[model samples]
Target: MSKGGDGKLADAAYRTVLEKILSHELPGGSVIQERKLAEAMGVSRTPMRDALGRLEGEGLLVRLTDRLLSVRVITLQDYLHSLDVRMMIEPQAAGLAVRSLTPNDISMLRSELAALEADESPQLEGRHWRFDDLLHELLAEKSGNPFLSKLIREMRRYTKIFERQTVPPRRKPGLDDHGRILDALATGRAEKARDAMAEHIRNVRKRILDGL
Candidate 1:
């Protein structure tokens, strides 16, 4: 009940660890020890344990044995598995989003995509990812289903390993894909929106798998 109590400290630990996981700073399959992590992070064991529990609950980490923890090592098969789930769910979310999304939301999404296109850094990887994430999150939220939105968020989270390690070089189609999805959503036709999203996701799945 108190701020920064066990739960709050645990949450702090969770965010710190999750950020590392998302950034791939802690690469997949890297072993994690609670006592060591707590010591490194200047946190107590309780919060550290709680944080590990939450990560495992999210399927971002795995318990290998009584005393072993490791970041989830996602294989190409794992990528396909997650992609299958996304293909099934995200297109439907996009379809439903057409009904729930406001004009303002669409405008914001357009702005984000435009920003992404304008970015010309020598290393445009992170910029590309941020914009893609924003677009997906917006679409998921607009679906008006919290469960659907959370699934999208988690799928994105777990797949960061692949995205960061192997950014498909020919990503121009991705930009166009996002634009197409947005265009379809703007038409306010659920079927069109769904079809567009399915195309985009399938394109991405191929892009990712083809590289491997």
Candidate 2:
């Protein structure tokens, strides 16, 4: 039982560490010393070691057989692949959402959209990303499939890294795309909603790849 608890602790540690890396707090390719992290996180070396091992498995961290660990750097190919997978998944999820969405779900989405539109300051762009995440979460919930929702949430993490890196310059246009998606969803048009989401995701990929 204690071992199971330790495993859960390690998993939580892995996730927190991965978030720090994605947010650039640790930055890509930064070296990670297990002993240092274990001390910093106030856990025993065993749990910290387990956490690092899990991160390496997830491709968020790379482990050297000799014991060095570093945050994984995002390559252009990685970016493209992530975009492709998101394009394939999220629009289909949106279509599912249309068939399942409740009136209350629609109302909440509208409220989030309104909040996103009202915020225009450069500093508030991070807040916009949070709202964008909420939109995706709501869509996932409306899909009425727990497993799909979990997968979407996991996939969204990669997109979050892309957004933090590329969103500021393209913030206005991104919001416009978001507005269009919300409009389609509001009308309960599944195909339109799916197409709008696909276009929005594609535009983001183009902007990122174009070095905007």
Candidate 3:
């Protein structure tokens, strides 16, 4: 394969491993045997190593004492700190995005959320993450600040790792929060959107803390 083809294979490996991590198929603290994983992925060990190296650099994987790689276990402090950063940034993004988000955008999000709510299959766990990703990412991308959007996306990844591993799936409450946020955004009031996003973040923190 050409150099470009090699890079593409590594990219595919990276995404596949990342999906497994986020979905908890390869839960935090589970060891990653490179040769075994490479075999399972049906790729050469070279691409798998490159993918693992990238994940390690991203803080999603760590090398333990014996030089074994494992998924990074997110600490509570890390989770809270990420949430704090999000609270500071996401509301601003939401406010800024009010004008940018079209009515069609709002309608589409509402429909997706409704579908998620109506879904009760075992696959709902995965769909929950998807919906959450779509909503936050849309707000960030529409916020008109590339820097702010980048920050939100980076912080969200860490927070989600913790949420998926430790926190139970919060379907109804989360959907309710998203609904309020959508309602606020639909009104095209920056303050309303800001307040709604802030409240949603606070509610998430409260729920997590209360359960502890």
Using lDDT as the measure, which candidate wins?
Answer: 3
lDDT of 1 by residue, 1-212 (tens): 56657888899899999988877888898899889889988989999999999999888899999878899987777777788899999999999889888889888888988877887776576777777788888889989999999988988776667676555444344889989988998899999999999998788887776776
Error of 1 at 132 (Å): 1.7
Residue pairs in steric clash, candidate 2? Answer: none
RMSD of 2: 2.8
Give the alpha carbon lDDT tens digit for every residue of 1-212 in model 2. Answer: 35587887797778778778767778667899888888888888888888888878767787755779898777666667777888988898898899878778778877877877787787666677677788888888788888878777766766676556544545544778888888888789899999999999988887776775
The stretch of ten residues in a row with the least summed lDDT in candidate 2 is 164-173
The Cα local distance difference test for each model comes to 0.84, 0.78, 0.91
Off by more than 4 A, model 2:
1-4, 120-123, 145-151, 163-173
lDDT of 3 by residue, 74-171 (tens): 89999999999999999999999998999899999999999999998878888988999999999999999999998998889888888888978765
> Which candidate should be chosen as best, given TM-score against the real structure?
3
What's the alpha carbon RMSD for model 1? 2.1
In candidate 2 the C-alpha lDDT for residue 86 amounts to 80
In what order do the candidates fall by TM-score, top score first? 3, 1, 2
lDDT of 2: 0.78
TM-score, structure 3 vs. true: 0.92
